[model samples]
Target chain A: MKKLLIALLVSTFSFSAMADGHAEWWKKAGAPYAGTVIQGVAENTPPGQFAGEVLAKDFEKLTGIKVQLENTSWDQMYDKAIKDMEANSGIYDFVYIEQDIVYSYLDRDFLVNITQSLKDQPELVAPMVNMDDFTTFIDYFKDGSGDVFGMPMEAFVKVYLYRKDLFGAADAKSGFQKKYGYPLAPATSFAQWRDNAEFFTGYCAEKGMECWGTTVQGHTGHPASTYEFLESIGPSFGLYNWGVTDDFHSCVEGGGSLNGARAKAALTFWTSMLEFAPPESLQSTWSEVASTFAAGRAAQGWVYGENAAWIASNEEKSVVVGNVGVMQPPTAPGVMTQAAAGEGYIGYFDGGAYGIPHSSKNKEATLLWLQYIAQSEVQADWAVAGARITHYSTYDDPKVAAMDQIADGYFTLMQNTGYLYAGAPMYPFHAAGRAAIDPFTYAALAGEMSPSDALDGACEALDKVMKDLGYQN
Target chain B: MNSSKTAWLLLSPTIVILIIVGLLPFLYVLYVGFFNWMPLGKNKEMEFINFGYNYRELVFDKFFIDSVWRSIRFAIVTLALELTLGFLLALSLLSSFPLKAFFRSVHTLPLVIAPIVVGAIFKLFLVQGLGPIPFLAKELFGFKLNYMSSEAQAFWTIVVMDVWHWTPFVTLTLLAGLSALPQDPYESAKIDGANNFQIFIYITIPMLVPVLIVVIFIRMMDSLKIVDEVWMLTAGGPGYSTRFTGIHIWKEVFEKRTYGYGSAMSVLYLYITIVICWILYSVMVSRGKANEDE
Candidate 1:
């Protein structure tokens, strides 16, 4: 009885001590800016929604600082933040700087260096916030002098997701083997991927099911289609940076491979897969493709990692819960070796970081808020809620380890093979480059032009845009 | 003060407001359009190129030129269809039957709804598998109705959406005009033993020309600058088939951040609109003068 009483008392004291530590830290660091209201804007993805809805409220309650985070669509978020920064309106205290656009933000000197800010004002720095706790993904948000600009909030790779129930079925295994002269499994090569797609499409049709072999993020209008091709599919075909050279040339005559044989082959392969995709493929963006897979309309597809946790576990939102499997995307010959050697990537590592804009009126308070979110204590829950991990320690959290099982080892694969994935190329003209190449991509998808003709036109357009931007003579 | 001074004083507030909100911004855009200015990037300073550089680029920019032509085409087709259907609707409403009030109320509902809402509604209605249009198409005719399947289908779908949205406004305008028409011409036609078609061609058509001109002018301008509904629906897709001038300029300014080029495009678009309106105004005045002379 004495031992039990002692144990209860000790546990109570420990819990209170932890709570007091957090309270005292906030009481000290956030006192001067207690009444300050910081505003931010981000794309309304899972992570962004979590930060806005959950973390903002928590931070306000603890620190007495109001955080008004606007979660908007991708286009509107970029437009609003960029316009605000350009006008120096100080409307937003912080903005979501996506991985691909950070280079441009750095070039324009739009973001405040967070590392320098914290160092220059040590009193505002929370003792618990340490930069070393973050994963290598933070490296993407650093400027040329290695000064950290944006604080890494969410990092994830686009991964291959397949319906395990369909692939593991006895009937499907025997049928696939008989038809393709191999054992049924997740695709490991482009030929195998096509065979699997064709077989499943036919098999499901014969079974009188409303299912397609794959989900294609091939929206003819949105930039998501261009991203899918250049970042996801093109890399798998041994093409990178849309086949543009480091010297800012994109056409074959300018010694670039954007219109080379490999690019044409990649385009053809991507377009041919449409036949095996759902009827909504032509209208499918990233979100639509995730929903299609969750609704059981697709058997396999490349899906953003943020949606993987829910699709594999959340029964209310996903019919494929407990039946989803994830793996690295199938790559062409030598691509895997190159990726292993850090020479190229096999797929897209897509995420974003929150950065304080130089025009922000409340930079110190915003820095504290960023540090609060970046604490190792909050990362595990954030990862589980958003299916994104930015801190290296988050991978070892007990909750995350448990979730890895439910997510079919998605987190584990990300941790193990993340080096093989890469973010968008370091280009200050990312949006311009994508815009120049997008119309041809849409035309090819809509059958208005052949793949060869589309790439040829796209390369020429890209070259012209680069030259006009003074990147080339 | 004298009566003329009072009149000018009353109009001064409105004129000042217009100058501040409209003319000033227009002037600024004109100034900006002469430079090569990108708000973001290392080379963001406003560099003055020649006055003709932007205009020359516009002439050779096949995408921009094609989008402008598409807008014109959309305006012509939609205006023609809306006017014909609206006239029919107005004539039918003139002689009411059962549930006429309900029909009128329902017809105006589309106009009352926001353009983005209309786009969202049609997008949900036409989506494959999830939407009812494709399901019904399959169930009723065994035909798969995928709007995003082809450029023509996507473009026509947008046209249909525009016609549905604005046709009611056109009907209401024409109805008001029809209600105000004089009875003398019709009585003269009936006394001369004229048929309905002949009377419509001669008396009604001649008398309604002014209202018809107004309706055409309004619809032409609105149709040519369409962005919201079409943006929400197709997003100028199925391979740039429906990329109108407004969408093109929006992409340039907002998406691509080519503010100078976008301003130039806007300037050109405004000039075109003004020229077109002037021609219509000239025709209306000349027609009125001829009638007055008679």
Candidate 2:
């Protein structure tokens, strides 16, 4: 009787202490801004959805701050946030800053320096929020002084997704070997990719199956086509930063290779794949391509990593759920070496971060909300929910590791080879550059101009845009 | 207070609101049009450009000019088709028929739907592999019909969509006009042994000219400023074939963030539209007067 009473008392005290320890940091950090409300805006992507629906609720429960996150379409999110910021309306406390646009945000001085803010307000800093917990992707959100401006919520690389069921079929293996003198496999080079595209298209046709070789995200009227060519396809052919040199020029005369022979070849290769792609390729964007792959319409293609998790595991939305395979994007010879050496990248690493706007009125409260989300404890579930990772620890989390198996090692591949991928170059003129080159890219895809002529025209247009923007004399 | 003072007091709020919302923005845009001002980045500093600079850039911008021409073409084509179709529809509904009220109500359904929703409906109906139209085309006709596969097809698809959505508005307006037509002229024509075709060509068309002018003016203005449906459909693609002036200006102002240049373009576009409407009004007035003299 005496021992039982003593054990109960000891366990009770330990439980209370653990509970107190868990609540202590939040209570102290959140006491000042307990009832404050902060608003944020983000695109309605999977990651954004997770942050808005799950993480926001969790943060609010821990801290007394009310977080209202507006998840909207990609275009509308940018449009609303930019309009608000431009007008200094202070409508959004924090906004989603895409990796591609962070440079522009930094140049405009539109975001608060979170590192500096935490340093300045040491009282508000949470013990769990350490900068080293985040992956090197945090560097992408930093300004020139290496002070973090945005808190990365999601980071992913574009990858080559192939249908393992199709590639591993016995008949396909035998026929590909007979025809190409090699075993059927995921492509390792552009020529092999073309061969695979050709073989699978014919093979599917012969079997009377409603399948295609690949999905070409070549919407002639949308920006997706430009992204596929310039960011994904162009980089594989050794064309980086839209072939623009450090001097902000894209033409050969100005020492840029935008219209160089390799760029022309890259365009030709991409345009040629249209023949083997579904007829809807001309109208397809990134979303459509993912649907096409999920429907088992394409054998292989470059797919965004955001969709990889669901496409590989969700049987309801995906027909080839367990059959999806991922690999590094095929690159030209020596291009891989260059990317590995940090000289360039093979494909796009796309993601976004949440940044408190300079115009935000509730900066201190919003800062606490951000740090709450940034805690290492919240990341594993977020990564599983969104197929994104911003911390090294997320890869080791048992949930993520289990998901990695179901996703055919997508998470593992991202962790192992993510350095080979790069985000958009740091250009404050990102939109201007894309707008200038979009017309030519569209024309080339529509077969209105030859690949060479299209690149030549695009180079000239980019040069003119740079000049108009006062970047050059 | 006297009657005038009371009226002024009542009207002051509306006038003040108008100045604050409408007049002030217009004046601000006009002022901004002559400067090289960017709202963000290092270019946020406002630099005063010569007035001719923006106008010159506008003149030389082939894409903007092409988009303007496309808008003009779209306006003319949709107006012609809508006027003809709506007039025919109104004429058909003139006499009493079975379920006449039901037919009229059902015909006006498209008009009440928002333009963006209409675009989405059409997009769902025509999208390849998923849409029923392509499926039916392949299954029934033994050939695929992908509307977005070609530039001509996409352009015409937009035209057809606009005509389908707005023709009901025209028909309803004309139906009201036709209902209110003086019966004395028709009776006189019948007594004079006029045929149906003759009656329609002479009395019907002549008397309906006023309503037709109203319809034309309204649709012409609306179609010139068309953006939402087209944007939802193509986003001005297939090599800028459907990039109308509204979209062009929107891209400049919003997407590219060239505020001053977009302002210049908008001002010029507004001025041109006013001039065109004025000329059209003058021509119609003269024509009406000439008919009166005759």
Clashes of each: 0, 0
Q: For candidate 2, write residues B1-294 as lDDT tens digits.
A: 999999999999999999999999999888889999765324678789987789889999988889888988999999999999999999999988999999999999999999999988988898876789888989999876666556787799899999999999999999999999999999999999999999987888778879888998999899989999988888887778788999889988887778888999999888877777788778877777676666
Model 1 residue runs over 4 Å out of place are A1-19, B40-42, B283-294
Report the lDDT tens digits of candidate 2 across residue range A1-473. 99999998998898578546756888778888888889999988778888989988877777788899999877788889988887789999999999988988888888899999999999888886667989999999997789999999999999999999999999999999999998889999888999899999999999998788988998887888998998899999999999888778899999999999879989999999988898788889888898899999999999999889989987988999889999998998889989989998999999989999889999999998888888887888888877999998899988999999989999999999999999998888887788778878878887778889999999998888777777766
Query: Counting only residues 3 or more apart in sequence or on different chains, how many pairs clash (N, Cα, C under 3 Å) in candidate 2?
Result: 0
Measured by TM-score, the strongest candidate is: 1
Model 1 compared with the native: what TM-score?
0.97
Assess the local accuracy of residue B205 in candidate 1 as a C-alpha lDDT between 0 and 100. 68
What is the per-residue lDDT of model 1 for residues B1-294, given as tens digits with 9 covering 90 to 100?
A: 999999999999999999999999999999888889875434778899989888789888889889988988899899889999999999999996999999999998999999999999999999877889889989999987777768888888999999999999999999999999999989988999999999887777668888888898999999989999988888888778988999989988876677788899999988887887788778877876676566
List lDDT for all candidates, in order. Answer: 0.89, 0.88
Expressed as tens digits, the lDDT of each residue in A1-473 for candidate 1 is: 99999998998799579767987888777788899999999998888888988888888888889999999988889989998988899999999999999988888889999888888998887887778988999999997688999998899999999999999999999999999899999988878888888988998999998888888898888889889999999888888888888778888889888898878888898888888999889889888899999999888999999999889888999999999999999998989999999888999999999999999999989998998899887888888877899988899988999889999999999999999999999988889888878888988887788999999999998887777777776
Per-prediction DockQ = 0.62, 0.52
